[model samples]
Target: MENKTRTLYMIPYIGWIILFVVAPIALVVYYSFFDIHGNFTVGNYGKFFTPVYLKMAISSFWYAFLITIISLAAAYPTAYLLTKTKHKQLWLLLIIVPSWVNLLLKAYAFIGIFGAHGAANQFLDIIGIGTKQLLFTDFSFVFVSVYIFIPFMILPIFNALDNLNPSLLDATKDLGASKWTTFRRVILPLTLNGVKSGIQVVFIPSLSLFMLTRLIAGNRVITLGTAIEQHFLVTQDWGMGSTIAVFLIIAMFLIMALTGFRRRGA
Candidate 1:
């Protein structure tokens, strides 16, 4: 009777994962390797290997890498400092609060700041320089993504850095290492796990980001997300949409696997 009761309690958690996470993945797997007219078709997967799809996948990774590197470089130090603070809880809140902002809203807000008539351009014009259209460019998308994911990177790094052994640095210093040498040899190596966790956590979904690329970047940047949206809504092509979705999943999984390997290596 007690075992049955315990099993029942666990069932809810297991069922929830199955219900939400597993089921959708199964559906994607089914669709990705099959056809559209409600039949089995490998053509979708076949078509996915073409140059255009490859280019999009490459482009997505290209941007994703940019954002990940930028976010990590910026967030790691902030997280390290916050984690080491006497008033750690307060500083952690400061790092986290921006993450609670609506993603779309934040993207849109970037539009207000980076658009041709936006504050940045206005400042440039004031300096007697010709204004550049910052919005709707690839740089804009990357810049905005870095901004959005900054907090995600920070939180993980803070968790890892917060739990870090400060005394380990003291030991390294006592062994006749300069501060930079100790930081390079000890602190960085110790913090690698957090950095790995943060990069994986930030890059995967950030690549799927449609709104940020769409609004700030216009349609010039067609992510797998935007392509899927186009097939479904604009072209009414569910098969192609599903195909793009499958590609996205594969690409994301590859990135995640790389992340996992890197984490283990770290």
Candidate 2:
């Protein structure tokens, strides 16, 4: 009866995974072998290897890398500071509150903030920087992407720091290790898994960001996500879209494999 009950509980979870995850991926793979006219062809896969697609892939990777790096740079310090705060949970909650808002809403809010004659430009003018076009630029895209992803990056790192053993720090100090030395040799290595987890969350989504490229970047930037959207929605080319998605899925899996840390025991 216990075994039957366990199987019953798993049925829904397994079914959901099959329906939402496995099925969609299988369909994408299937469609990737076809042409726009629904004819079976491997040409879509070949097309992805072309210079245009290759460049788009590289550009997508570069943007994702930049977002991940900047988020880490900002988040690690912020997270470490949060760990030192008396009201760390409250502060962390406040930092994360902005992320609770819908991404579309946040993106639109930035549109107003970064628009010409917008708050950003107005502030620039006041500071003698003068108003400049902020919206629909690489800067805006990267800035907004970083802002959106920072909370996610911080949360994991904060958890890592919060859960760290205090005795280790004391032992380090007893051994005459300086703050920087302790951090470099001990703290960082221990928290490295959390950093990897943060990177996994931030970098993967950054690779497939389409809306930000449109509204914030004014379509000036083309990531794999934007290309996939264009092929699927604008050009009505499911085969190519699926092909791009397949490669993206492969990339996502590769990242997951790299970022995933093994537990101490089986």
Candidate 3:
């Protein structure tokens, strides 16, 4: 009876996944292999391997990789300190509060901060420094991406660090391990799952970030996400758009696989 009840409770969740997740993916797959006229073709998939499309895909991966690395680097230390802080909850609340703002609004806010006469350049001018171009550059795009995604990375690492058994650290110290040695051998491995989770959360979204690329980078950065949007909305080429979406999904899965995210006992 208990098993039956549990299964019954899961029915709605399973149905929801099938209806929303599975159905959309299935549609994408279908459209990827068909043209607008419903004729079967491999041309859409073939376009992805062409030099221009391939370059865009690589650029997208590179941008996402940079964002993930920077976010992790910043988040790991902050999360570690958060674990040791007296007012951890307060600090965490502050860290996540910015994420509550609308993403477009946040991007727009950075526009003013990074504009030529914006706060950053104005402050520099006040200090006898000449104004420099800050907006519509790769740096601005990456900075905004890292700022937006850092919270995602930090929360997972904080959770992992907070849940660590303190006795294990004491044991490592008792064994004459140096602080660096303890972290290298024990703390890092233990918190790796959190790191992996954070990477997935940040890296995946960073790959197909269209809005920020347009608003912050001023379309100077062309990524796979931008390609998809152009194909679907501007060109009205649903087949090509679906093909790019499929490729993006595959790339994400490959990243997860390479990270050992699916390894047994991970």
Best by TM-score: 3
Backbone collisions counted per model: 1, 0, 0
Tens-digit per-residue lDDT, 18-107, candidate 3: 999999999999999987777899999888899999999999999999999999999999999998999999999999999999999999
lDDT of 3: 0.93
Question: Of the pair 1 and 2, which is ahead by TM-score?
Answer: 2
What is candidate 2's lDDT per residue for 116-166, written digit by digit as tens? 979999999999989999999899999999999999999999999889999
TM-score (all chains, Cα) for each model: 0.89, 0.95, 0.96
- Scanning candidate 3 in windows of ten residues, the lowest lDDT window is 257-266
Looking at model 2, residue 128 earns an lDDT score of 100
Query: Candidate 3 — which residues are off by over 4 angstroms?
Result: 264-266
Tens-digit per-residue lDDT, 23-69, candidate 1 = 98777666665455667777876776899887887887788878888
Q: lDDT (0-100) at residue 13 of candidate 1?
A: 99
Give the root-mean-square deviation of each candidate in angstroms.
Answer: 2.4, 1.8, 1.5
